[model samples]
Target: MILHFLGSRGCIDQRSSRHWRHSAMMITQGRERILVDCGEDWLDELDSLRPDAVILTHAHPDHTGGLERGAPCPVWATPGCWQSLDALPVAERRLLHPGQPTAVAALQLTPCPLAHSVRAPAVGLLLDEGAHRIFYSPDVAELSDPATTLRDVSLYIGDGASFDASLLRVENGNLCGHAPIPSQLDWCAAACVKRALFTHCGEEIVSGSHEEMNKRLENLGKERGIEAALAFDGLEVKF
Candidate 1:
């Protein structure tokens, strides 16, 4: 499996050379290419990626705005996501159910519901490529099924909205905003996930000193018995 982070910036005013664009990713396996998330920053330029299909994590403008112009390939999204994307001119729309594995590009993708914006509702994905397994959620407040969803996963890519401080809020009985990096690391540790990468960077991540953040993340990872790192645009991971 091969993965590329097309964008890593979160919904914040901050933008740097390393964390400029909103979160988006491209996964390629065999001859198939799947693009995930198409934030507002990408709205004017969707033709460059040339994806065979597009998969959405949620309907937030930061994750779905780029599709306003329609896509060249099929688009897959959860029912909730479709509710927000219904007006978009995507060429094709397919349903992907939570807890149900959907086949795409010879890989199995299982959506795991998460605690996030009630209006936009989000889902973390479990990508299984037979030889490799990964769970990725660029924005999450809490995961519904951590144990089952993260079991034996090789890599865990998650929200980077905050590092040590809590940026979460409870609204109308649903958790919203991003969980701190420390909290997510604990989840990874409990699930026995050995490596983790964070994207969708918030102000702290985009403005903080990379050296200091790396040290802090390294220390946190050491305590959790896992390897933790931040992801930037154009970053690639292959396994």
Candidate 2:
């Protein structure tokens, strides 16, 4: 399995030097490309990658930004996600019913819930075969899935929007609900994750030096004794 990230920016796409990251990801697992998310401006990239399945974790605009780019092959999302995505006029809106096994480009995937700040319950996908498993999660407060769904996962990706709890609560202050990076790590460790990744970062993250953030995450990983890395746009991972 190979993971190709076309864009990794979290929410909004503020095109500055620090935040060039888009918000698209493509996974080439079974000869076909399985696209995870596609922001609006990612049409150019999608035009190149004719994906077999476009999986949607949530109905947020940054995640569904480029839905019209494709003729709409197989778009997977939770039932709530479907309710939220009612505005989009797509060819197919396959509802991701929990615990149901579905095919995504030759690989079987299961949908699990990830409690998020949005009106709809967010999702965390487990794409696996008889042996290998890859947990793909974005835009959530923490890992809110049932334990059986995430046992001994090989790769884990999650939302890490802010640097700390203080910033999470204080970011623009009036902005109600959001989770931070440190809190996200807390959830990952409790989940007993293997080879974890922190993505869906806020704009402040891009502005601050990744080196500094990397240092902190490195220390956290050492303390927890687990594998973790910061996710970036255009990053390619071969499993």
Best by lDDT: 1
| Highest TM-score model number | 1
Worst ten-residue run, lDDT, model 1? 99-108
Q: Write one digit per residue (lDDT tens) for candidate 1, span 147-231.
A: 7779989899999999867888989988898999998898998889999999999898799887777688888888999999889
How far residue 202's Cα lies from its native spot in candidate 2, in Å, is 1.2
Give candidate 2's error at residue 20 in angstroms. Answer: 2.5
Badly placed stretches (over 4 Å) of model 2 are: 13-19, 69-72, 145-149, 166-178
What do the candidate models score in CA lDDT, each in turn?
A: 0.89, 0.69
Candidate 2 lDDT, 1-239, residue by residue in tens = 78886766777545434346555678887688888877676656665678888888777777776775454477878788878776676777677787788886676888876656456556778878556787777676555443455687767776656666443322232322356766655655666765677777676666677888767776776676667777877788886
TM-scores for all predictions: 0.97, 0.85
